[model samples]
Target: MKKGLKTLLIIIAVILVITLPIISSYNNLVSLEQKVDQSASNIDTNLQRRSDLIPNLVNTVKGYAAHEEEIFTDIAEARSKLAGATNVSEQADADSELSNALSRLLVVVEKYPDLKANENFIALSDELAGTENRIAIARQDYNKIATEYNTKRRKFPTTIIASIFNFEEKPLYKADQGATEVPKVDFAD
Candidate 1:
């Protein structure tokens, strides 16, 4: 009986020793996933901030360039798409669309000297430019966190734990295929 009890105790200890690392690894993966999520959220917040700024800018430009209906319509449509985007990749694409539309709108504004010199319009443009910078920084930070999470989750025993937890990879915020080309709103003429 004593020998049997000792064997049982040894078996329990071995099981715990083998399982503890797995449990710890699983917890670490969860933490990394949460970090990536938080980073993504931060980027979304900046995107929303920029989107919110668009209305005022659009309204100001509308007064100066009432005939530019197409640009306004495109901006509104892009904004709607951005608002309804369901995933990170969709949101990024919509964001780029909105940026292009807004760029076009700005180019149209350049046709009017008064609008270009308006203090309110200039302030809004500065704010929009600053928000764009913020979005870029947020995206960079999110990508870094996501890369770390993905790498950790795909390696060794952590991969098994990640699979068990269903922690899938995140989509990178990549530029569109034509991103290297000039934006459609070029007014170099």
Candidate 2:
């Protein structure tokens, strides 16, 4: 009986020694993935807030610059694309397009000093700016957490576990090409 008990105890210990690290790694990966998902949701929330504010901004600008039909159309189209975007890459591209369209609209506003000075426009602009800042911070947080998760998942024993569990890599958010360029505003127009 003593010898049989000893054998059973050894088997249990061996199983624990092998399984504990795998369990720990999987739990850690799950926690990090949840953080990444929450951060992505934060970005979407901020983007939605900005989208909600655009119509008010557009209407205020429209009141002053009725003839700027082309810019308004562009803004509307860009807004539609942004609203329909399904993933991070599509969101980035649509965001860049909306930003460029807004820049052109700003130039139009510049032509009408009164629009810039309007209280409604000023308030909406401030809200939009704050939301944009939130969006940037959210994107940064998402990338940081996602990078950490990816790194951990790709490491030694964890990599084996991650592969078995199908922990696919999360994509890092990248800015659209030419997003850094200062949109040229033709004052001549």
lDDT of each: 0.90, 0.89
Model 2: number of clashes? Answer: 0
lDDT of 1: 0.90
lDDT (C-alpha) at residue 85 in model 1:
92
Residues 35-142 of candidate 1 have per-residue lDDT tens digits of 889988988898889889999999999999999999999999999999999999999989989988987897898899999999999999999999999999999998
Strongest candidate by lDDT: 1
Error of 2 at 24 (Å): 0.8
Cα-based TM-score, every candidate:
0.92, 0.93
Q: Compose the digit string of candidate 2's lDDT tens values, residues 1-189.
A: 699999999999999999999999999989998998998899889888888898999999989889889999998999899999998788888988998898888778788888888899899989988998998999999999999999999999999989999998989988777768885645575
